[model samples]
Target chain A: MSRIEGRFKQLAMQGRTVLIPYIVAGDPAQDVTVPLMHQLVESGADMIELGVAFSDPMAEGPVIQLAHERALASHTSLSSVLTMVQVFRETDATTPVLLMGYANPVMHMGYAAFADAAGAAGVDGLITVDIPPEEVDGINSELQRVGIDNIFLVAPTTPEERIAQIAARASGFIYYVSLKGVTGAGNLDTKEVASRLKLIRKHSDLPVAVGFGIKDAASAAAVATVADGVVVGSALVDTLAQAFAGGGDQAVALGSAGKLLKQIHQGIANAAS
Target chain B: MTRNTEENIFATVPDEQGRYGVYGGKYVSETLMAALAELESVYRMLSVDPDFQRQLDEDLTHYVGRPSPLYEASRWSDNIGGARIFLKREDLNHTGAHKINNTIGQALLAKHMGKKRVIAETGAGQHGVATATIAARLGLECLVFMGEEDIRRQALNVYRMKLLGAEVIPVTSGSRTLTDAMNEAMRDWVTNVDDTFYCIGTVAGPHPYPLLVRDFQCVIGREARAQSLNQVGRLPDALVACVGGGSNAIGLFHPFLEDSEVAMYGVEAGGHGISTDQHAAPLTAGSPGVLHGNRTYLMQDSDGQIMETHSVSAGLDYPGVGPEHSWLKDLGRVNYVVADDDEALRAFHTLTRVEGIMPALETSHALAYAETLAAQMTPQQMIIVNLSGRGDKDIHTVAEIDGIEF
Candidate 1:
């Protein structure tokens, strides 16, 4: 089993809900990303999903869009993102880090080079939002050769038969989108998401991480009740935006990350109890 | 065997990697990560939904005028060395262009999603006009973003969009053209994510869009298939269309992709020449990069910044093409070549004088190529060209070029 899968299994046995914190890599500045990632883990994050920036992100919400713009303005390439992952690995090697982004950067770099670089950078897995099962073969073989998990998504709209296909290929975990539309645009229908999760569980033995529109502690708590983990992105990016807009000193940003992580943890813990 | 031939071409596409060839892939912002995922799911569901297909078919037949005809241009054919040429008359659609085929399909999708507003970006104003027409018909508030330069050049189209009750927003950003207008439209979609739908003009953008738009525009090919077979007693020797964002080209070529006996050509704009930076031939000079919503072939500078493109025909002035076309070219299924401004202008006048048809400057590129190809072939050879739009909008521009007071 992969490190992320093992961690999830351990957490499951301990009756603990996994908290996955997501942040846009190279946002604000490339130099500060590793520190912020460390801060996230130190606060309470069990796994880290680092978003690689792209120029035209059609499916993004405003919060993440601004973050991408900031990264692109700094000219953050996929190479730089992997370099950051390598830097993070220098200090903390065991903490699972997944590169979460679109497929262009991977395609642009060539699949073999990307898989090698990602493996060397200590990236445990990849969750490309746009690489469907039909297109996975282009990069899947390289990823498998490098021992990197090819994570897949199963949405509420995914039929049962399709879910089985996705689950068969999916490693690491299945990212279950909790709602329709872009992230940060809609409210989560907990009952609907939970029922969908139940259906996914029947077909796939993989851990399910629910994301999209998991804004506050309450939403996180609601998701934790049914999902193996809760992936929070826009809200965290929103917090970073507010902190930076309000004079982002290092102390202020770290403090913001700590406070948000603690609240989300409390919510998940409360829901589990 | 009949059904198998039809299925073979489409099966080659959306390959094991969801790519049409090497052309289609997700090249997007990290912010939209989850949203793209959700869209993929919804698209997969809707693609096979009987209700969705029925609704789209109904709109295409009753609303957009299904099965636009294949007119055998006998006069033009006789003038061009007696080589027979037929025109798929998408220009006769309700909006005077083929762009409505896609806008109407996307508008219905927006309605199904409960979106109250629709936003679009335009270059030659055909897409903007199509979007505005659909938005008005669907009873949704519409906004169209166009480059300030395009707004000035295509003034009548801008007026038409306004008359259709769409708010035309002038974009004064980089190059002040289609690419910049698309950027502005994306910004609008990002801000108004709650109840807005972004109606992309062509078979471009993220994953599902390339697939979705192609499916909608396939009616052009499907209709032409029956018409051509009935009229010519067999399939044409060649399929030709001009590629801007590649909607019309795909519309015509898609149904014939698997016909090994038939050849396909997509003419790109070689503004000054292919060697110069002034051309809009992405397949000829561009590298694979992410622009708009998906990763496709794009004309970009060394720094990976998209370059400004130029074409005498505003519709053919884009720096990138639909992802599927990129893939198609890579797979060698279609030959993508360029026709310079001089050649296009020559054909534009030739069509007007010989055939009494004032072809759109965009379609003139294909005609120019056809003229050249016709000279090299015998009279027995046949070519079917997609006459995508009328030249009415270009009269002012053409007249000005001729030093005539319009």
Candidate 2:
């Protein structure tokens, strides 16, 4: 089994919903990323969705867009992001690390080459936001050959036909965009998410992970009840951005980020799985 | 205006999946796939619908002033002293550009789809003004996303869009140019896919957009083809147009693709020069890459990050060209050339003095190449240049360049 699948299975047996916390690989600074990844794991993050910055991040709202900009400003390329993943993998071999971003960067590094590099760097899954199943065959097969799971997003607007299509192509868990808007948008509407998860369950046996508007402990807990996993992205990035920008040193930023992740992790742990 | 027969190999491109020889696809987020599918289905149904065609045809004639004159530039032709030259006056169309052709078509689609709101992205503000004009006429809410830098450069056109009751949102990310505006517009569309229609201004974007926009703008080549036969007693030997996102160039070239004898040239902005890394000449100096939702020729850095592009014309200051243009370049059907800012500016002055017609800087790029191309051919041969837009919107830019403030 893949690292992601194994992690989900372990969490399922423990009757705990998984918490996936995302961070841009080079946000704030490059040197801080590896240490931050270790900190996130220590704070009870079940998985990590490492964002690889692209020049244009269309799916992101203001907060995450700024995070991408910050990451890009540090001269972080896809190659550099892969290197960061390699460093983070040095001590933490069990935690699943999924790379999430747009397609152009991955396309820049040829699919076969990117898959090989990402696999060597210990990336367990990938979530290329712009590439749907229809356009993912080239990269999917390459990733599959390397034993990397291809994760996909199921938006509220996605039809049942497309859901089945995505489900057939998808491995790992399905990321359900909780809102009809970009990341950092508010109003979770857990009731609507519950209904959509039921529909997605009909199409795929894969676990459904809800994302896009889980801001705090309460929101995370609310989604943890309906989802197999909860992905906290823009909210967590926003916290780290503020922490780094407010700055004392690397330790200060990591501490603040760890604090927030722990709170949400506790909320998920306490929720009724 | 007749379409090329099905037997014409060039006539059946972009296949049903919107692939123009592997250069175009719906490389967008899944949040947008359903909407694109719906748009494609509706557009397909309405394209053959008699009532929809009638309405669009009537609007083109009465509202946009179709059959914009094809004027023979005898004096300019004599100055070049090689080939006879003609100008397709797209500058004379309503809203002062060819952008209105696509906007009008898409606004009608918005109405047909029962969308109460329409959004667009613009660089020179011409498309914004055109979209705003149609939105006002159709009683649809209009929103235009423009780069902060573009808003400052094209202030007059921005005011025109505002006067037409469209909300102009200034995008402040990623070099603050047309590419960024497009990115912001995509974000808005993804956020409000249900009630809003994103009326793309050019022959770029994802699948249906390129196909739809090109079809709407094809009236240019169709009209020019008939006019060429009637006025010149034959088809012109060559066709030339400026290519930014390549809508106008593709519009003028699509109907002539099957005419194996007729050659075509697309002039890209060379900025200072392609060698200096400042130009926007994607087809000339760029490599094939995916950008702005389609696989196309793009000006990108080694890391696949889109690079900032520079051009005197805001409309042509883009890092990527339309996917169809990339396909044509690869197929060697059209010659992609470059006209630097200096050459385009000289062409602007030449056309104004020689033909008593001032062309937009974007159009001037084509005029520059047409001059050189005409100079190479015999006087018996003819070249038709697409005057894509008027110079009225560019007067301020010219004045600033001359170090004259008014």
Best DockQ goes to which candidate? Answer: 2
Assess candidate 2 and give its TM-score to the true structure: 0.99
Chain B alone, model 1: TM-score?
A: 0.95
Q: In candidate 2, list every pair of residues with a backbone clash.
A: none
DockQ values of all predictions:
0.10, 0.84
Q: Per-residue error at B405 for model 2, in Å?
A: 0.8
Residue-by-residue lDDT tens digits, candidate 1, A101-129: 87666776789989999998899989877
lDDT of each: 0.83, 0.93
Off by over 4 Å in 1: A9-16, A242-259, A262-273, B1-89, B100-123, B131-162, B165-239, B253-264, B271-279, B287-333, B340-361, B367-385, B391-406
lDDT of 1 by residue, B282-363 (tens): 9888898767766689887643556789998888889889988987887788999889998998989988888777788899
> Candidate 2, which CAPRI tier?
high
Measured by lDDT, the strongest candidate is 2
Model 1 - which docking category? incorrect
